[model samples]
Target: FAALARLAAELPPALAVLVGFVDRERRGERTLLFNAVALVRGGVVEQVFHKRLLPTYDVFDEDRYFESGARPLVFDAGGVRFGVTICEDAWNDVDGPLRAHYDVDPVADCVTAGAQVLLNLAASPFTLKKRGLRPAMFAGIARKHARPVVCVNQVGGNDDLIFDGTSAVFGPDGSLWARAPSFQEQVLVVDLAPAQRVAEVPASDEAAALDALVLGTRDYAYKCGFRLAVIGLSGGVDSALVACIAARALGPERVLGVAMPTRYSSEHSRRDAQALAEALGIAYRVIDIDPVFQRHLDALGPSLDALGAPGATDVTWENVQARIRGTTVMAISNRFGHLLLTTGNKSEIAVGYCTLYGDMAGGLAVISDLPKTFVYKVAAEVNRQAGRFLIPENTLTKPPSAELRPNQLDA
Candidate 1:
């Protein structure tokens, strides 16, 4: 309580605020309860409101820790009366009579109690399509009540639940005002004017998605205690794109591109790999793997013969080459304590197109989730920013091939 008082005294005033959840039991009772909403000013907490509804079905266990509070919590800050709701409160229609049987009516109780703004604090988990629906739902709520609403979501990966913390605000007219990036923890400040209608603004959805991936990569690498990234430079579009993204996210010097060519590697591929490393300004190393390939073939000669000469085909031969490159990259990673980056794209990862322990070998797969179509787009974007063709134009235009045999393209 003393800490809360001191904090309230030092903090700036806001209309409505939420503190962390409190796990407690009611006085003289053994039942556990989770308190939901709290109003804070400066550093002091003014009031604590327990959640009125709890959900306990697939993936939710809120009822195990919460006793519902029946009434809405209304507080005033910065000349605005705000109504507060915890995660599951607004999710249920029975919490308030006005909200029953309607998507936006429960907020009526807050307005009746003199709340001019609605603030919802949530820790919603991520799904493939849930992100697309959240903004629209909030906008509908705001429009129905003719009041601005602010949503603050918890962010980070907790077990299987990944909170895509893109907190947002909507105007009285149900138009989005500001939105934080997804999958990241961010503090977003929104200026709200009473009865102001939000105007439709152009949004860069692709940019936002790309930024999320970039942030995820950066955080995963840095937070997991990795400073250096190693990429196999095959002079193919996929690897080139991964190299570009890694350089941008973790700085050029932190990224190392290795070009491992064999007897079957095309001259164009070698030249292109060198060009890409120079263009990205990252350190590049050329390690000829012909000797290693020969050693592997000799070691597996008896088995190859037993398997009816499987190594004689172009596909088998290409896979051998890929495994050799994978081995070389892993060796460097082990020696220097760097994170090996796999450059396979989504199109390949799908339908089991990628080799399991070959090109797919890496500590991190940068573009493994990105489709080949998107790979080209992002690579083009990188080049567009560079103001010149840093990735050889031929590399982008050429059909992708494993280059394990003469004149063979990846099917």
Candidate 2:
């Protein structure tokens, strides 16, 4: 508040600033947090708007953490009665996805309170083509209120979350005045007093997903204080795709690929992983796990003999190979202070096809939310967007496998 007050003091009489921040309030021995936006002018905060429509579904938990604001906020600044809203406050479109969630529309409330302009500060997470729908909703709000609507969304990745900054402005006639690009960070200057209007371009589904993953991976690593990443390469599509994302996210020089080959590992798999490493110009290492596998089998052989099992069974040996590989990569990650990236797809995780503390041993699961089918598509997209095979053609075409046992296939 002090910093903003000082900044407001320095601003000219004709200018004002709108900023989003978390507000803390005490209510009868309980501390409450509210997602809020403030309008400032002439060294004083004119009005503060708390978010009303707290979304609680599909990755959102606002209702659990925040106290909803009781009323809308409208304040006079620079000859305009600007209305301030924080995120979900302006998302109550009649035909929108969250329309049924709330009865009162914040946009309508602002206009009813005599607001000339509408402003929404948001941190909306990216999902498929979710970016395309927001502008349409804002346009509707602008048309209904007869007020120019401006939306500023957050950009970059936090943990596994991706916020696409497609900030935009619309005229009272429901026409787009200006827009910032999706999945990128840039300062957008909007002139709502525009002469010409442009239509909103629909974002491509595959392209947007690729960009979101890359941004999420980059921001997640940087925020966690990791400049380097390591991935256990199986030369399958899943690992190959993750390597591509890591290389792009942290630069090829910061990514390391380790291939742990065992007795059941295929020769083509080794070559394909190496090919990808060379193509991306990342550090690569090959470790033979057969000797280690032999040691484990020897140590467990006597214990298994008591269980009436002669040799390694489906319940044990295949997992032994997986655990060996996981340990190898984890050691590399820990030794070099690298973030270990797991390559298991959502389908495997959903059905518990993943090994505990084995293939699942990593600092982050890069593709745990990606399905096996979508894995192939996004991997191909990595190559397609590059206009060349950064990931080898054979890697995408080959049958998916963990190579933990002979004649095994993930299909």
Candidate 3:
């Protein structure tokens, strides 16, 4: 609160601010944290609003750390009365298969309290489906209240969670007044006026998704203090897509593509990887792992025989290749101070098809949320937009494979 007060004191007089933060307060014998928002104007905090609805499901666990607020907070700003609500408060009236857990209607309370406008501050996570549903949810609340609703949402990737900052304003008639771009930061300044009809919002789901992934990748690397990225190019859709994303995020100059091939790796696969690196204009290198793999088998064969496992199973040998590639990439990342990018798609991640210490090793998982089918879709889109095969035609048309064994497909 003191820091926020100091910040507000430094800002220009006409620019009042609503700042969201965690506030600690005494609750009986315990100290509780509240998800709080404070309105600061003229170097003074005029009013404070606490989040009433705490989402406890899935990625959110606010109920464990925060005490729910009891009342709707209304304040006068620029001679207009406005009500403030946190993320889940405005989501109460959303019609969905997901069960509503809260009974209080914060938005309704604000409207009934004579609020002319409503403001919702949110840190909503980005999933493709959840993002698509947001505009309708905000519109519904606006239509119900017969007042303009403005929402400012946080954006960026935090670990596995991605926040697409598609902050927007909606008119009382369920019309969109203004919208900020998704997955990036921007200042949206709109002159307030009476509600009026507007055109339907443009449809760009796939493009928005691509932008989200690109922003998520870039933010994750920057937050972790990485300006350079390293990726193992396997000539598969997952790795191809990951390299493309990393290049887009960090730029071609900052990305390095290393292709590690063992004896089992196909010649065409190597060609595909090299071609992708060339197209992306990223630094490319090939490290042969056959000698290292052969040495491992020779050394471990005796130990396996003594344990009544005379020969390494197919899975074990396959893991050896993966671990070798993983080690190579990690060494490169360490030596060059580059962030390592893992190339596992959502489908493989769901079923644990990837080796934990091997292919799963990376500073970031660039396309881990995209399923296998979606990975291919994105790869094709990349080529289509480029007006040529940026990822190489063979990489797209060839059957998916780990290439750990001869004639082995990714079945």
Pick the TM-score winner: 3
Q: Please write out the lDDT profile of model 3 over residues 1-411, one tens digit for every residue.
A: 788878888877677789998888986999989999988888777677899989988888999999999997788877899988899888886565433557888888888888999999999888767666787788878888788999889989887777888888888887888887777777777765543323232255555567778888998899989999999998888899889888898899999999999988888988899999999999999999899999999998788768875355448888988999999999999998999999999999999889978999998887888889888888888887789999998888889999988899887
**2 or 3, greater by TM-score:** 3
Query: Per-residue CA lDDT of candidate 2, range 1-411, in tens?
Result: 676677678877566777777788988999999888767766776667788888988889988999999897888866778787778888775466645358878877888898899888899888764666677788888887788988888999988788988788889988888877777887766566775333343346666777888889999998989999999888888899999999998999999999999889899999999999999999999999999999998999789878885544455888888898889988988798999999899999999998998999998888888888898888878888899999999988888887787798877
TM-score for model 3? 0.94
**RMSD in Å for all candidates:** 5.3, 2.4, 2.2
The regions of model 1 sitting more than 4 angstroms off are: 1-17, 20-38, 42-74, 85-114, 122-133, 153-166, 176-189, 194-206, 307-317
For each predicted model, how many residue pairs clash, with residues at least 3 apart or on different chains? Answer: 11, 0, 0
Model 1 TM-score is: 0.76
Off by over 4 Å in 3: 27-29, 97-99, 194-204, 309-313
For model 3, state the Cα shift of residue 41 in Å: 0.2
Q: What local distance difference test score does each model get?
A: 0.74, 0.84, 0.85
Better of 2 and 3 by lDDT: 3
Question: Which stretches in model 2 have alpha-carbon errors above 4 Å?
Answer: 6-14, 193-203, 310-313
lDDT (Cα, 0-100) at 15 in candidate 3? 74
Error of 1 at 394 (Å): 1.7
Candidate with the larger TM-score of 1 and 3:
3
